[model samples]
Target: MKKLYIDYDLFLRPAEKDQPHCSYVLRPGNDGPACLREEISFLFACRRCEDYPCVNSCPNGALKREAGLIKRSGFLCISCKTCSIACPFGIILPELLPYLAGRCDRCIGRLKSGEVPLCVSSCKNGAFRYVEEDDLKGCPDIYPMGDSIIVKVFNWLGSYGIKK
Candidate 1:
């Protein structure tokens, strides 16, 4: 069975000897088509709103608040996408299957064994990291997109007297 995993590492800058050496990055993984997309991020997207709109939007009661986090009941879910639509930040994706609603368990067995999660240890470039949520303070929630061919053409045209 395929499992969804987080990458937990995002390199914002290249390594430089004179710059301050910073470590730690966490983001959603995009290993395969089945894996979570790099564009989505639970840590950065989920605001944990006071109203819990996602949970309340579940008509079948598939989502519930447990221990301050939203938990999804796969069996009860009909994949109606109500939760996703209700989420103001667009964190809960509508494409999510019923079973993937409340996916990450943080690898309980690994933690009990005094080891990091499989994704963290499996990273080849030493990019994966684990850090307290507090470290993410001030990090921007929105990320810029890389320019595409269409955007480049538009920019070039806009530089001239080309209108529309």
Candidate 2:
């Protein structure tokens, strides 16, 4: 049984995100840019804003800044998505927010039945897959987020072959 991994390089393009996939169980939705960009999202680390706009925007106070990084309380999150918009960096995406507590079975029933996980099967862009654990060796864009999840983020501006 291979672990599941997700590889996508389309976060910087919001217009293309208008596709039909709307389930977190399928992919880590558009949370903005990854690494190697001026105005992109961050998964390896947070920006650590001085006056965290995202924290203040949370009506439920589910978000708080600790150790310079913003952390969310899974129990307190109401799924309002207000924080997402409030995020000055736009890294607070829906997929990063849990619908409920921070607990996901990862579609155990589906995997047990010898089928790929929901995300791997329904991913229209073909970003998800099952692979041996050793395959986790990632590239500059590839980030190995534990729990059998792999993230391959794209440097949006670099995609254009633009010179900095």
Candidate 3:
């Protein structure tokens, strides 16, 4: 199946052509679609804080550190946004959290018929694309977020000054 990939580098840049937008009108007070589009928080580098605020912030122990990465428990996550606020670097985007993030659907009916999603069509900079799994090979900046969603991480200012 085709998957959704977003150029987060382009996504963060100011749009010179037009204001970045998605035609998919999410319901009022419902930002599920917005979260679905930006669900790339896992790719964010986990700051080895002396005390992991995000992990401790979870009331249900839904987050933990494993192999230096912050692993989230989908079954335990309640989409409480507490962790998002607790993140010191603001890396944890609440919108992309599982159980809390709304489904993007990939414009399901149309996608199955060989058409792109409304959000993909709306991005003038070509930041979003629905591509085959094989199309992602050799792209170092692109990482798969889930079974059908990928994200591009490039030119990120956050990692600019840290020395390895």
Candidate 4:
């Protein structure tokens, strides 16, 4: 099975606050961004085990595990509840919803904007990136050489009419 690796310690650094803390799963062709099914599944499993208090503590029914995804309905989120207080996973930043609908939406927005998301953009070091599952089999473990490699490569190619 393919695995997504994240440097949790890197995310904690004050310098990376603008960046998304986790790497996105890359998708193939037009299939779309890497489906986050695996990551969502992991979170759901953790919730089931009650390893974290989030599942039980969510005041709003906004948080739930379904279809191997840690799904959240923003419309249903009252903003009165303190879901983050119970989980503290930081996965769901209720505060940023006006600008970011959710974690995955933030990532997709970055890709659409022709810019890497804050996390990928803010890394002074090339520490974060999205890699397709199949590509991971042969890729090196280290972060890709420089920050914003994806953005740079895509932009450069776009000059030649090559759309990513």
> Which of candidates 1 and 2 is the stronger one according to lDDT?
2
Q: Can you write out model 2's per-residue Cα lDDT over 14-73, one digit (the tens) per residue?
A: 345433232234335422121122112433434566788888999998987765556678
> Candidate 2: which stretches are off by over 4 Å?
11-42, 66-69, 94-103, 136-138, 154-164
lDDT of every predicted structure (CA atoms)? 0.45, 0.56, 0.65, 0.40
- lDDT by residue (1-164, candidate 4, tens digit) is 22223343343343534444433444212111112222322332123323445556667676676653355665666665475566554544444323223333335555666665545454554544444545554543233222322211113223445332
Best prediction by TM-score = 2
Tens-place lDDT per residue, model 3, 1-164, is 58877777665553656324443345433343355544455444445566889999999999888755577776788988899999987778765575743445556676777777766766677677778878789977666776777777752435665321
Tens-place lDDT digits, model 1, residues 1-164: 11222332332121432121211223233122112221333323355678999888889998777655566676798888888889896767665544433333445566667766554555444433444444444653322222200000112223444322
Q: How many residue pairs clash in each candidate at the backbone level? A: 2, 1, 0, 3
User: How close to the true structure is residue 120 of candidate 3, measured as C-alpha lDDT?
Assistant: 71
For candidate 3, the 10 contiguous residues with the lowest summed lDDT are 23-32
Q: List the residue pairs that clash in candidate 1.
A: 8-25, 8-26
Candidate numbers sorted by lDDT from highest down: 3, 2, 1, 4
Instruction: Please give the RMSD to the true structure for each candidate, in Å.
Output: 14.8, 7.6, 5.6, 13.6
| Top lDDT prediction, candidate number | 3
Question: TM-score: which is higher, 3 or 4?
Answer: 3
TM-score of 3: 0.58
Alpha-carbon deviation at 135 in model 2, angstroms: 3.7
The segments of candidate 3 whose C-alpha lies over 4 angstroms from its true place after superposition are 14-33, 43-50, 58-85, 93-101, 154-164
Query: How far does residue 19 in candidate 4 sit from its true spot (Å)?
Result: 3.3
